[model samples]
Target: MEPTDDFYSAYDDPTGAPTSMTTMSCAIENAKHMHTLLASLLLGRKKDQLVRCDIDASGLYFTAHSKGKSLQIKTSMVSDLFETFQYFEAEATSFRICVNHILDGLGVFGTSAMASTAVTCSYSAQEGVFSMVLTDDGVLAECSIKTMVDDEHNDCSLGVFERSFEGAKVLGHMILASNALHDACSEFHELPTGAAVELVLHPTSFASSSDDAMCFRMQAHTPTSSCEMELHKDSTAIVQVQVEATIAASFQWTLLQAGLQVLPVASESFLRLNAQGFCSIQHMLLLGSHRAFVDVLLCPDAA
Candidate 1:
């Protein structure tokens, strides 16, 4: 009897008393029972330092405290628990039959009262590693003897798949995080109100390291003056502006980098108009590592 035929035949009439039908039904029931037991064990009973269990459509998520820091565990693919078990077994540990339910269920050939099967598995944490034993019987199954180090951040120690925060920094095939971008822009102040400015950014160099210093040449344009700026990795930035003062006029300008407007360079320097009717004042500003050079542009007027 083929496995498919046996399954259909068992479903059609479970009481047929055929040996193949009986075995097929037994295996299906065993798998179902195993799933039920795992669900119950994961969702039930309070254990040491285990505070919260949150089950979502994705999988099981839980938080526990170990050594004054919070640790999180996420278990996915639980609906196909047997397949998941097999997957883990293939990678790390093999299932051991401490007791066989099938042999014990036959009774005459068995010696164990519990009719349980257990497998030992090990996992790692930052400070240390731990082991666990998962047992299953025809009636019930539970993960027991789980020992882990009391560390605050256990997620850092899990394997790639078991990680609670996997691929969190991945954005559009890039490893850059939003916070990194935000931090880079935070050095600039807001754009001045109603000031028309044109920004030009030039990438001076690229390096192998993600954190390498990038050199940029920026040009900011205003109605009466244009400023050129140079930014480097050392957080040092400089701006040189040539202004054409018609009547000792005062206008506000802002420096923008990575979409962030930084503090405006306040200038009270007098502009001595040249024969071209424009005066140029050269200035330099230094910024820290959390900033990047994107472009030089004028901003809205400060009305």
Candidate 2:
């Protein structure tokens, strides 16, 4: 969408003031795209706390942390997610800002405005105030949110993918549609909040049984699904499970439930298991013209 006159116009400050200072800024042409994406990442988050923001020439990254779980959401704003993205900093800059404030400034819906909101985000390089400007139907509202130093970094790495999982025994590997995995998680809601979702990997079929006794089996090769497994003592070679592998692993049903949030954006997902009973779930999502990936690592319960 083309930028409107109000959207492109620049303002020195919210109040009628004149200033010569220019700030580091970027504009998300379609605020709805950002609003929906943020909502998905921030779902189930209770506290409206500070989230780390990293802005660079590559893209914008937001990291949310609570309890012991940390989620890192990344997307390219220059070309992929944002219609127009610009960062003035030569090196990457990090700051702390409240997620609730950004969401509130977006105002995706429930507003009386007739036009979609255009958002402009700026940070004062000197004063360090993060500001958001929203324009809708010729009306503009600007907010300056205080920023804080981000001295902490969350080490949220995948943890030695090739060494750990490669040498470990491959219990089960299944590829299913995003909706299929979502339905599997939804069915477990009736049993218990923390009940484990059991996955039985067979030679030719993959069966998912919830704590509520709801069980369903999927073939290894179906028109719409695919399942594969390895039963050898030590082998990473993936082959269709044609015999009973007797491999069973359980994962926290709540984690699967949380993963369902990606269904609306994901197309297909692959589920894998390791000898240590670690399960990795990967989702392929299409974000506008770009393809994005989301992976969840779930630790299995003791047998």
Candidate 3:
């Protein structure tokens, strides 16, 4: 079962002594912008599903686990997004809270307003509550949602994916505008179950093929006004397909479709794959004053 933020206030200890606490507070001038970007991270059926959020001097990080935690998508809200940023912790501080609660709290300030809503978000470890104060047009609203304690046994780690990616043999790496890739993937989105979407990389062109017995393939060549394709084996540099060897990998069609979610907000994207067909898509989303990186790793379909 997934974790969720509670609606009730945290129960105090029987001793009545306030326990050790960790607090992080920040003020933002544009709540709507933050709310919009954050809403994109919610996916599960539970409207109040918990998401791991980290706040630090550098930025705010949010991560959502999907596919039984095998897949993770993370986004960042840099300090530039805040009008006043103040965080204190012995180490990186992380909390799990319901994303919907945060959205609802921020959404109180309707978009029709001429100016952005001023928001102050604070959380205390001892209280286990995420509090938000929103002021719009001189009206103030305060919201408090209880946070979830971490479950060590249920926590997921990215070490497996990281290690696999680090050791996989790079077959090809390509770069393209987010829209361009999304447009291409749309053609293969309807491939029947068990069918695989194949990507063939040429030195100067790229093609996405689907094995539907129709032999349908959508090809894009480099030097096009919007799309750029590179294929190489040297992972250290921008990879380009070798002239002597053309590389191809087949991934589940549905997995590639997930990349489309990033297109609406991202400016550009990068695609990389290994000989074993494992693939990763990285996109940089454009927030108002800051930017975020969203990466999705998809396992390949069996040959």
Candidate 4:
């Protein structure tokens, strides 16, 4: 049957934005030709069965419903289905002439461009399904269509190739390092003595079957060679560091000995050191008498 103006009216409604009218018309004409062919193929078997056809820009979808049974046709392949239908439409032919034209078109059985480009096509006679997958120039295209006798379901699937590199390991490492540096700077306080300090954390080591912890060792070195100290952590939960400094002979010894005394220190100054080699000099104290001090080193070790 020719595509009437009513068929085109289905897409004219403003509510549904169906833009490709030319493609839709071609699909409708193809479906009509398929309907006629199917009728002739089943002529001797049943005369009461009614085959209906519908088409759009995407492709053709046809359904034959009769005697509590249905069969569907889906045109997913980019083939002569469109061209043959256009030929018949231009000829202004009857259903019989259109059916003959369709058969003649099918006789050629020209291969698709995808097929010529190393694509493989397969058909399942029992399932009445066709599939094509092509790979060329590092690009892939695939299409699948299925039609069943006495079944209302018909579907098509198409896909194109693209490159994807998600969940890469390098990205994970960068994110982890950024978070660690941010937390160290924001949460740790600065020391009174002007010495460059940073965290030197060690990887977690397994001490026992049930217990595991990290170790840290902090070191602070100043311009003068007079003062140098090291701090250590004896256990995973506590921060214990030893202070040893060498001061100039001219400076009073009392200044170098002041920080050695047992004084109440705040929690912010007392950072938890868990792993070996984990260091932070943010808590070192400066004494009034300790001038010409070499460096103050704080180192923590897992006990």
Q: Pick the candidate with the highest TM-score.
A: 3
Give the TM-score of each candidate.
0.18, 0.64, 0.71, 0.17
Error of 3 at 256 (Å): 3.8
Q: Extract clashing residue pairs from model 2.
A: 203-241, 203-242, 203-243, 204-241
Stretch of 10 with least lDDT, candidate 3 = 209-218
Clashes in candidate 2: how many?
Answer: 4
Q: Number of clashes in model 1?
A: 21
In model 4, state the lDDT of residue 5.
Answer: 14
Q: Candidate 3 at 176: error in angstroms?
A: 1.6
Model number with the top lDDT: 3
Give model 4 RMSD, 1 decimal: 32.5
User: What is the lDDT for 287 in model 2?
Assistant: 56
lDDT of 3 at 277: 59
Where does model 3 exceed 4 Å of error? 1-22, 110-115, 187-196, 203-255
Question: Which of candidates 2 and 3 is the stronger one according to TM-score?
Answer: 3
lDDT of 2 by residue, 1-303 (tens): 111111123444554222344345667656765665555445355545666677787776765433354223332343356656666667888776666666666773334431277777777757767777777666677766777777564434424433445667776675666764555444344545545556665454335432222122422232433443222312222212232354566655555455557766677776677767666666666655666565555555553
Order of the predicted models by TM-score, top scorer first: 3, 2, 1, 4
Global lDDT of model 1: 0.25
- Runs in model 4 lying further than 4 Å from the true structure: 1-24, 27-44, 70-80, 84-303
Q: Indicate whether candidate 3 or candidate 4 has the larger lDDT.
A: 3
- Alpha carbon lDDT at 228, candidate 2: 36
Q: TM-score: which is higher, 1 or 2?
A: 2
